[model samples]
Target: MITIRPSREGTAVAPVLVLAQITSLQLGSAVAKDAYDHVSPTALAGMRLTFSAMIMLVLVRPRLRQIIARQWRAVISLGLVFAAMNVAYFQAISHLQIGVASTLELLGPLMLSIVLSHRLEHLAAALLALTGVLLLTTSSASLSPLGILLGLLAGLCRAGYTVLNQQVGRLFPDWSGLAVAFAVGACVLAPVAAVTDAGAVAEHPAVLETGLGVALLSSLIPYALDMVVLRRIDTRTFGVLLALSPAAGAGVGLVVLHEHLSVRQACAIALVVLASAWSVSRSPRTAPVPSPAPVSAGDNLPIKDTEHQART
Candidate 1:
């Protein structure tokens, strides 16, 4: 299991946390892409959600009854968005190369980090990311306009997912929010996937195995790691980690799939990653979003216990 060290009395590494999340996320996506030809993206998405739901339920055992009725609508909305994002992005990967699809999807986080962010540094970073995206994408006119549009939609959904997850993290605490979200996502996606993929995904043992691995890599491991990191790390650190997604995707694609990226693409990834980190480092928190009931206690630890630790 990953660990979450206590944050320092007055410091936080939110940027770094974002960076780590990006790294794991891109790699997971790359891995999932390898399985696309083997099974329908919907099937893969359904299985991923199902496993994630199971894992989260077993780990958190959240009190569903305690959730306010007012939040149910938001929960359902998040689930649908999450399911669509997963399925659509996966399907996009089947058509677009990892570097391309991931770069496009990245626009979501960059836009999100920018729009929600007021820090000059983060805004600059967002601009840098935009430039990098342009370079990375313009290199290949082979990109289908439809694929690009789909990729954009995926990015929007992902941003929605990010916002919803933030809401969940604030309200639920620890892993409970993630767990509940995954459960709902699974609930929404499974039936649709069942109807869509039907028997095609079943008869192929290799496809099933690939799909399972994709689910594990894409959903289960990365999320659990992210929660642990967030509990231990800060938002800026998280954002920094998030910046690494493109690079990670490129690396995994090259190393595992032997799909090398061009010089321009590599530079674009670097520029965005560095800018995002630079931006997040300068951001200041507006206010503390309420940590969920389950994870909230950790946030209450005494200052003395975390002497000279990482930021809040």
Candidate 2:
């Protein structure tokens, strides 16, 4: 079994990778939003997953024969999560401002982190994040009910993705699992797009070209970066780090899509950010490392040590 030791370089690079991920992901969302004129959200989501799957499959060429049934289950679960999350998020942004949708979506991971920790501090952070979401949602008369519902759905799927990704990471020595997951996601979304927006793609052939860029920026780059970061950090830390997303989404929305946020909305995002910072600050500087366990031949793969210093 592969064991990952913590290094100072790993600790320092994790946050930077997260920052780059946020930028790339938010920019992709903005691009997708702008391209909505050419394609429906479902169609665009399908195209993104399809292109991502194609690129990853060609590049990684995962050995399907070697992956065990248990590993297949995890990869399939993650793929379904990806499909659901992307479709819901794309729908949410079609109705709501990208920033607002992102903030609402973040609740899933924030709540997940709090539930996993079951500490007073994490609870406090959740409450603060909830308050921010409430402030952002209730104060904005422009927010759509459907958008809110979809954003929450996306967030829930995102939480599942985070947990499942770690499991997949342990099951595979490399990115083979991710490649298979993307293919699964593509298969799942293809039919949905055909039923929901079959005519959109035909009407706007250029959307396919745009989809390639969106897939790279939104799905490929950010996801690959996320996998790298997740290998070095625990789910809780990863969730908290995503607190930067709302602000990044806001800035990208404003700059790229010309979607503006009100003062209260900005304050709400700030509250969420502060809560994330506080939760991270409250985490223990050191965690007890568990002894390595024996692995069967079927499960021989690298395992991430969640107790690593990079978790901070």
Candidate 3:
């Protein structure tokens, strides 16, 4: 695997990029929710992936001919995860409020963090986040059970996506892997969208326009930023930073979707946020930077860099 040391510049910029990612992501989700009346969640997800794929492919133009078998495996795995995660998540937000769906979906990464943790404090952090989830779930009697289940499923897929994406990143050493993954995702979801909601997009041409916006805000921009940020930080740190996503989602849901959270729900989100912050505070101030992998002249493959660049 290629490992690149985190530079001072990359480290400093990571948090800012994450903030922008979450903000854009939440805003995109809220916008997507608005278009659900005209399009099914599956169709919209297909559109998002298709548009994102086109954009990334054009921008990165990955050298498909040069990709080795192992790299192809990683990229394809990540693509499948992406397809599953987006479909489940979009279905989730259809039933649950954006904030609530986001929080529930976060369990995937939180669980991943816990599994990877060797320290006691990390367990404590997990407990706190679980408590928050429990509170949020119990607080709302109106939440759809289907939404809850879908959200959890999305979380599981998200965890897989996180792991596989980092692997693909290391394999490709650039965004080329991501571009190919997006294409794979689009291919996976397009047929499902056609089977499930074939007429929605045709009937509502406006769905295409809104979908482009959603693709830009939710998929392309944030995912591109994710590639950049993942190259600069550890997965645990990345997961911890994602603790802010619930709050961002809540804000966007309120402002854009007019979804109101009860006091208990608000407190629940706060607890999750607090748990993430606590984890970060207790973590080592600086991670050990590994030396970059040596690039061979005959190797046409991109060099993987930064073992620490893996994410939640």
Candidate 4:
């Protein structure tokens, strides 16, 4: 169990971080969809991972020399998950309708949070979100069965990445955990994807620009903001706020991507927002204490970084 310190800074920083993560993710996806018009989604995904990885590598200077064998295993696992998640998700978005596909991608995290919360109200919230997802994904009567399968697999991969990150964050050094994962993901994706889309990158400069936008919106902004927030909130509470991500994506799509939501979709967003608010409100006002990992789990777990903040 993770103990929560009231982040003295979380009050000011958490919301900002949440907003940053949401908008960045939204713009990234929207920009990516735009990019697919020029380059294959695989190539675009590669570019985003590559650039984001570079930015963090330049800034953080992670202690590569001190890395342990176990840490290397953890890092590689996280990197593979991240790479698989990105490539599959980008491909799904390329094939399926954007709104439906995105909602699908979000399923893994939403389910994890709800299941892990183990609360009745959260169960209902999960159902609501799941129902909305069903509607969103299945509403397209002609939707390709193969596309849906790919999307759900991508969602599973995303869940794996998220779970691994939580544990990795406890051990690996700060954003270096994410940074290394993204770098490895980029390298793995680049050679295979770029070769196939070689002509697209050169033929369409706009394609490359879209990929850059995706990098900025998705990877670069969110990780830094998450670092700020992680210093404040426990992993569990952090997951709850993450539920708002899809709603943010919806808003972003409407404003920036010009993808309007139907009345039903609008209603779904309202339900998800309300449910998330209630889940957070009902949880303990003082953040839960971060428990030290079981001795059997490992001796090398990181000391949880806790900050005290004024209540919002």
lDDT of 3 by residue, 161-270 (tens): 77786667666666888999999999999889888987777888989999899999999988888877776666766666676778889999999989998998899889
* Local accuracy of candidate 2 as per-residue lDDT tens digits, 1-312: 333353445545666898899899899898889989878999889989999999999999988877777778999999999999999999999999888888878888877877776678877877787788778777677679999999999999989988898777766767888999999999999898889888888888888998899999999999988888776666776777787788889999999988888899889889878976786566544323332343334665544444442223
What's the residue-level lDDT of 214 in candidate 4? 85
RMSD of 1: 6.3
Query: Where does candidate 2 stray beyond 4 Å?
Result: 1-11, 284-312
lDDT of each: 0.67, 0.81, 0.81, 0.68
Candidate 4 deviant stretches above 4 angstroms: 1-16, 227-236, 287-312
Residue-level lDDT of model 1, residues 1-312, one tens digit each, is: 222233452125554445555566667676667666666877888888887788778987877775664345556676778788888787777777777777778777667776755666666777787788878878777878877877888878877766665445545545656777788899989998889987877767676666566667777777666655544444433443455667777887888778888888888888877776676455443333223333223244432212122244
* Candidate maximizing TM-score: 3
Give the TM-scores of the predictions, in the order they appear: 0.81, 0.87, 0.89, 0.83
* TM-score sort, best first: 3, 2, 4, 1
What's model 4's lDDT at 174?
Answer: 60
Worst 10 residues of 2 by lDDT: 286-295
- Against the true structure, candidate 1 has what lDDT? 0.67
Tens-digit lDDT track for model 4 on 64-179?
A: 66666666677789778867888887888667655666677777767776667666776676666666666666555777777777788877886776666655565554666677
Better of 1 and 2 by lDDT: 2
